[model samples]
Target: MATRARGRGSGRHDGQPGHGRHTTATARPARTRNPLVTAPGTLATPADRALRGKAARTRVPRSAHASWLPSVDRPDPVAVLERQGRDRLPELLPIRYGRMAASPFAFLRGAAAVMAADLAAAPHTGLTVQLCGDAHLLNFGLYASPERALLFDLNDFDETYPGPFEWDVKRLAVSVAVAARENGHPEAKAGRAAQEAVTAYRTAIRRLARLGELDVWYTRIDAEQLLPLARSTRHRRRAESSLGRARRRTSLQAYGKLTEVVDGRRRIIEDPPLIEPAGTSDMAFLRKIFSDYRSTLSEERRLLLDRYRFVDAARKVVGVGSVGLRCFIVLLAGRDADDPLFLQIKEARQSVLEEHLPSGPYVHHGHRVVAGQRLLQAASDIFLGWMTGPQGRAFYWRQLRDMKGSADVAGMSPADLVSYARLCGTALARAHARSGDRIAIAGYLGNADTFDRAVTAFALSYADQTVTDHATLGAAVAAGLISAAPGV
Candidate 1:
């Protein structure tokens, strides 16, 4: 266990101070509901107002963040990777390391736990929020809301939980910095991108704090709305191109590419390692899981789901960090062959942040993920729910691919990259404000670029660390110390 120097409390609710030390991972008493989200004008309190003054007066200045990174006895980054692989699929663990070895940015995405360890050692304001524990640049994307409208938000929640809001922002800042480097952008450009993300987060949270609570909760950035934020014609053009492609990426579109007629019926296409049909034992086990999942859904949703009958399922490998985790795609059909539904059943484990933050209130990690998603997202999947499997594994289920899309940062020019960075920052702030005390957080930030610059410096320094860590992983793969199946 590690401990960070507590700068000054935000005068808000008490977050786990000195989180680096060992904490209990067992469940605690359940909370009926989140108290941060309140009716208009009720989100803040008299204490919050006084705390704002206290924070602005005596809290550690943001500039002090420049020296937050501890230079002593840091844990071995390679050892951390090996530790995380312990419970993952042995055959697929190599692919996880291989993808991480692809580039520094890829490594950043796959190494959330590594950064979480570092962040636990850094100085932080004691402001806890339901954090997107792995809030890297790529994780923020466009997805279909319940209304069927495309909206921009944090799309990954595998590690979402209660932790310092700064952790999420720091991860995002480093990701932008690393992405810029991966694209061969100048160091100055990379620094500027990281700074812009911090600035956007600061500005957005301040604005949201001033608004009525409901108004802030209701706010969401739609795909079309983001175009106006682009700073240049090039930025706008690239965003439009990305948005156009996203609009066509519906469940129907995925059905065409991911399925085919097998004799007289349709089934998921097999692409060994990446996508393969389930075995008899797995299929039987999944049937029971599906029944438990249906019980978790609301009556209306269950009725809607009942209209479809289970057809088939397959093991599907997804994402860099989640590569070795157990994930499956289940197919269902309605009255006709054209009527289809795809549900993604992903295994849920304790959040990486749990080791450094407060333990979750939910007994099941699947419930923790679902509850956190609902708390952070402006709107979530109608099918989102969770269930425990016979083997005691927890899982969350959601629509497989309904108009989901992420930006191709590699293709973006430096200018466009900066613009995208700001968008991600804005999304991160919005997500935090939904489940955190916006007024308290805004007060801690003040109206200065002090924190912004400090975080940018941290991001760049951490980006360098990431490069070194990534090289270590690559070396391990080459040395035959670890198996690595490339070209997945």
Candidate 2:
């Protein structure tokens, strides 16, 4: 096995390749930067390292890569969509077509992990940390509680792992700035916003160092605290209101939209392709497996679920970035068709974390994702769990979007945008502190200014490449090398 190739269950095994955490923190100097970030991240195993050859050439600084990203005229946007869709097939039902037709930028937002692997592997001066691999402008957001309290946090952790801290921080700064530029903010203004994100990250890292290790581990950002930190009375009042609105965002709420009551039977509404059931064979198999799945759950959970009877299910497509991948939403009905419960079981592929770190003792990749996500996120879906089926494929289950919300990247003014950037910056560092040493990280960062400069340098440069990649896909589409049904 070459150094770059992480194999099945390779994530839990420490024997093979790069640095990574398995289930907990490691005892090591946090200040050490991986030479691989600048060097070739060649795995000890040649076979794995061979995969790194896809785009090994050196190019201009990442800051420069952004200039050409917006030139959609140079690339065929439709072809890019087709390439993205190609990976998402056999599982995509038709209802998600409207979502796929959402802007190219929206698609880019969902696929940031795909971008991170290409960018991080390009240069390997191995600055490693517990990275939020899918960091981007809109991924940061607020969630509320039953009592109507709002808390800010990093909402996505599907791609979090030990990797270059630069990758996480750079992705955020560039995303916010790039997103701002797309919204027509001035260049200098956009640059400053990016800088503020770096500042917040630097500031947060130091604060994390001050907390007791266990205290830091126990901390969570509460939604109700927004009342005291409110920038204005109006802001406070609005937060209080949004909190109330959040309570209604439940599985019950979602069930009403996705299913219906037809003569007292709770069934999913099928309008052509939008939301439909799986084929008869798949459904028949699932019916039996769901009974088996119930036995696998804890007695308490099993009893809780016994209240709801499993109904028919379908492979449902969801989210812009995940439009082309395998995803399904299973429906359950209790007592009456009106009392519905929805469970989202998304396919868990190997994480980008696996590529950077060697696998440990884990036998399943889904276990790795579930374990890593539980460790990293301050708030997680209550139903989070992992399972396997059909060729031993892995999947993690959760409530799809229970009270889930995102930042208003398009709506925020420059000032509010900077404020939001700072929020993400702090959250990213906090997540890193969970498995990586914050103090050693702070020492390496050493007063923040220099680290901030390096981050800004990399962020600006990589943003430029995303634009280039976008254009390359565009050209492929125009040349008829790929099939495209744009604005789907």
Candidate 3:
């Protein structure tokens, strides 16, 4: 059983809700006490760790995970979302709501806070890992590693933090269920799809447990390996096409599409509300922070960064859950006019999981995000770094695009979804094995499919809850209680 606590008070800063202003606040130190630490002693051996995991089953039965009745006093999902927007840019909150209202799957992507609260309401196996925090179906994708090898892994970490390993699994399972329903799959098929993800997670963890430390660390799901998993020739061709598209989605490709030469100098093209020119003061602040960000990188990386000259920047809205956060894209030229690089600086707020679990090790939210990404990813962006800006806002920097691609979940056939779900589960288990105790987790899971079946039941139930929650958000928008700019 994991120790639990209600989240502490939120960090608050007041700002006008409109566009074009940098909301500033004094930086405050994060809580230093870490409640997750074990007793100070020699590390437990694999046998001992496995025994400890088995011991946990007596306290929190595997069957306990299947229960998913909404508590009588469950927080209203809409109110929970409104609370998150309190510190966000006011003008953009509607866009977030609009995007979330588009589908139950979209709502699941945006409602990490809601799920965190619900997960906290239950007892856990106490197996801890650096969670992806919001491990919905869409968050898993392909990206180029530092070595330029394409690998599929968890790509989003805005809410990454330390917590019970099952939280991530449950989130992933629920997402699979919700996505299947949205694609017009029946309840039985959705259940099977969700079950496949948990089964893969269980089996993968067990396999990783047998590996040596270095072998576990070196494990990664390369894009080339995915081709063999495709069931038919058509599916194989589709996989190849997707991989080809991802390979083309590099900084050079973005430069061609997102830049236009203005007065003989390259400038980021603006697409109103979605993408717009930064104000003069915002641009100056970005330039100053560029050095602060550079300091966080290694000497070699700094030299690589120094080769590029800053050309232009623009504020850009991105993603469903992240719509209201402060984000900017900076354009830099490496050689002459043809060579280009794009880096994104996005705001990093506290993880939604923070309130449910104990405080994490990082003081700055940006450092927390960067560190979590490095720990959870098999290979991370070479340019990954973090910095503080005016008003002590936390922000992390990374390449704007590096062969990134996500599956089209809504268009997937039932078979395609089940296969994709298993892939995501395998990738997720590999991530957990890197950060958490694989031996103990594999022990707790055991040989039976009990945990898998239980989580599948929970996923189906939660998918129903998500539908209601999604409808509730739509109702709020319909009643004029919340504004939504649909189809943006």
For residue 174, give model 3's deviation from the true position in Å.
0.4
- lDDT of candidate 1 over 289-333, digit per residue (tens): 887899888999999999999988999999999988899999888
Error of 1 at 138 (Å): 0.5
- Per-model TM-score, in order, reads 0.91, 0.76, 0.92
Write the residue-wise lDDT of candidate 3 on 32-107 in tens digits: 4222234565567778778867876875667567767766667999999999999888999999999999989999
Which scores higher on TM-score, 1 or 3? Answer: 3
Better of 1 and 2 by TM-score: 1
Show the lowest summed lDDT stretch of 10 residues, model 2.
Answer: 1-10
Model 2 C-alpha lDDT per residue in residues 1-488, reported as the tens digit of each score: 00111112212112322222322223221334432233477422322222222111111222221221222233244443454455456344232333433443554565554554444333332335666677887777675433444556776666666665656777788787677666777766777778789888878877887787788886667766645645788767866776666666777778867777678766777753435577887677566556645654568777877898878677775655665555667888788776777887776665655544544335665565666666777756555667776767766676665776665578767777777787788888888778665654564555626556545554555455556555665565567665445544
C-alpha lDDT score of every prediction, in listed order = 0.82, 0.59, 0.87
